[model samples]
Every structure is written in structure tokens, then in C-alpha cells.
Target: MTPETVMEIGVQTMEVTALLAAPLLLSALVVGLLIGMLQAATQINEMTLTFVPKLMVVALVLLFAGPALLETLLGFTIRLLEGIPELIG
Candidate 1:
């Protein structure tokens, strides 16, 4: 592939990765932020307080987004595999 093509592929790969990860990541971020706020408000400085909610939120996101995420990854993989010969040729 040309440099431009390689760059394009790289950018697309990153975009797909970010798209797949965004829901779970954003959920975790929001949960963490909420936990932080709660901690600040109550002056409850327990480090572990953040872990359970974040884990639960992440798990919930994965439960909800799992199918879509898997499909996205599968599609990306299939496209990449289909392009392999073109990439080599």
C-alpha cells in the first residue's frame, strides 16, 4: 500500500477502536466522576469506593454494548482480511 493508504488504514483502525471502546470508557469516566463527587461531598476518602461502581458500570456497558462491539470488531477484521491480498499485491 502507498503511504497515504497505510495512513488511511491506520486512521480508520483507530477510529473503529475508539468507536468500539467509547461507550464503555465514557461510562467508566462518568461513574468515576460521580463517585468522586460523592466522595468530595461526604468527605469519604475511600480509594476503593470508586472501584465497585466503576466495575459495575463497565460491566453493565459491556453487557449492553457487547453485541455491537463484537459486530464492529468482526466487521473490521473481515474487511482487513479481505484487503490482505490487495495490501500485499
Candidate 2:
């Protein structure tokens, strides 16, 4: 592949990765922030307090958004595979 083609593919890969990970990551971030705030307000500084909630929230996000995310991933994979021939040539 040409340099531009390689760069474009790299960018696309990063975008797909971010899209795939965003929901879970974002959910964890939100849960962590909320938990932190609650801890601060209550003076409950437990080191492991955020773990379970973050895990549960991420699991919920995956459950709800999993199918659509899979579809998106599948579409990207198909497109990338289909472009292999052009890249090789």
C-alpha cells in the first residue's frame, strides 16, 4: 500500500477501535466520577468501592449496546477485508 493508503487505514482502525470501546469506557468513567463524588460527600474513602459499580455499569452498557457495536465492527471488518485486494495491487 502507498503511504497515504497506510495512513488512512491506520486512522480508520483507530476510529473503529475508539467507537467500539467508547461505550464501555464512558460508562466506567461516569460511574467512577459519581462514585468518587459520593465518597467525597460521605467521607467514605474506600479503595475498592468503585470497582464493582464500574464493572456492573460496563457490563450493562455491553449488554445494551453489544449488538449494534458488533454490527459496526462487522461492517468495518468486511470493508477492510474487501479493500485488501486493492491495497495489495
Candidate 3:
């Protein structure tokens, strides 16, 4: 592949990576922020307090979103594979 094609693929890979991670990361971030707020309000300075909630939220997200995520990844893989001949040619 030409440099441009390589760069395009790299950029797409990054985008897909970010897209896949965004839901989990955002959920954790929101849970962390909410936990932080709750801790501040109650004056409970427990660091481990946020960990469980974030983990649970991420797990739930993955459980619910896993199929869609898999489909997305599968679609990308198929597209990349289909383009191989064009890339080689």
C-alpha cells in the first residue's frame, strides 16, 4: 500500500479503537465523577469506593454492548480483507 493508504488505515484503526473504548471510558468517568461527588457530600474519603462501581458499570456496558461491538469489529475486518487485493494491486 502507498503511504497515503497506510496512513488512512492507521487513522481508521485509531478511530475504531477510540470508538470501541469510548463507551466504557465514558461510563467509568461518569461513575467516578458521581462517586466523587457523593463522597464529597458525605465526607467519606474512601478511594476504593469508586472502583467497584466503575468496574460494574464497565462490565454492564460490555455485556450489553458486546454484540454490537463485535459486529463493528467484524465489519471492519471484512472491509479490510476485501480491500486487500485492491491494496496489493
Candidate 4:
């Protein structure tokens, strides 16, 4: 309820969001970079060339990181719910 508490909650929310999104975003970035390099070297300027590989990499990353991501989100949710009583008190 307090400004400090509200700010803390907002910061934690942002942190959790970033943590959850990092893997997918990083995979996309890496795939894009590699595709860019390949396109530059081969002079193939196909705009859609990067999409499929990025999608596949993202899928693979999600497949591998899904459990840890779920665990992290679940932990954060449980912690947030548990803190409600403390915040109210």
C-alpha cells in the first residue's frame, strides 16, 4: 500500500518479466545475427529467410527452458500470494 512497497512490487514484476522473456529474446537475437551474417556473406537478401530459423530456435529454447521458466514463474506467484497477508497487515 505504501509507495515503497508499491515500487518494490513493480520492480519485482519487471524483473520477473525480464527473466521470463530473456531466453526467447536471446535466442531470437542470436538467430537473427547468424542469419544476418550468412545473408551478408552469400548476398542473399531474402527478408523472410530469418523467420523460420528464428522460430525453430525459439521453439527449441522454449522446449529446453520450459521447466525452469515454469518453476521460476510459479515460485514468484507463490511468493507474491504469500506476501499479501504481510502487505495487508
Candidate 4 C-alpha lDDT tens digits along 1-89: 79999999999999999999999999999999999999999999999899999999999999999999999999999999999999998
Top lDDT prediction, candidate number: 4
lDDT of 2 by residue, 1-89 (tens): 79999999999999999999999999999999999999999999997999999999999999999999999999999999998999999
Off by over 4 Å in 3: none
Which model, 3 or 4, shows the larger lDDT?
4
lDDT of 3 by residue, 1-89 (tens): 79999999999999889889998999999999999999999999999999999999999999999998888888899999999999999
Q: List TM-score per model, in order.
A: 0.94, 0.96, 0.95, 0.96
Tens-place lDDT per residue, model 1, 1-89, is 79998998999999999999899999999999999999999999999999999999999989989999999999999999999999989
Clashing pairs in 3: none
Position 58, candidate 2: lDDT: 94
Residue 19 of model 4: what lDDT? 100
lDDT of each: 0.94, 0.95, 0.94, 0.96
lDDT comparing candidate 4 with the true structure: 0.96
User: Would you list the rank order by lDDT, best first?
Assistant: 4, 2, 3, 1
User: How many angstroms is residue 20 displaced in model 4 relative to the true structure, after the best TM-score fit?
Assistant: 0.8
Candidate 2 segments exceeding 4 Å error: none
Deviation from native of the Cα of residue 22 in model 4, angstroms? 0.8
Better of 1 and 3 by TM-score: 3
Runs of candidate 1 exceeding 4 Å displacement: none
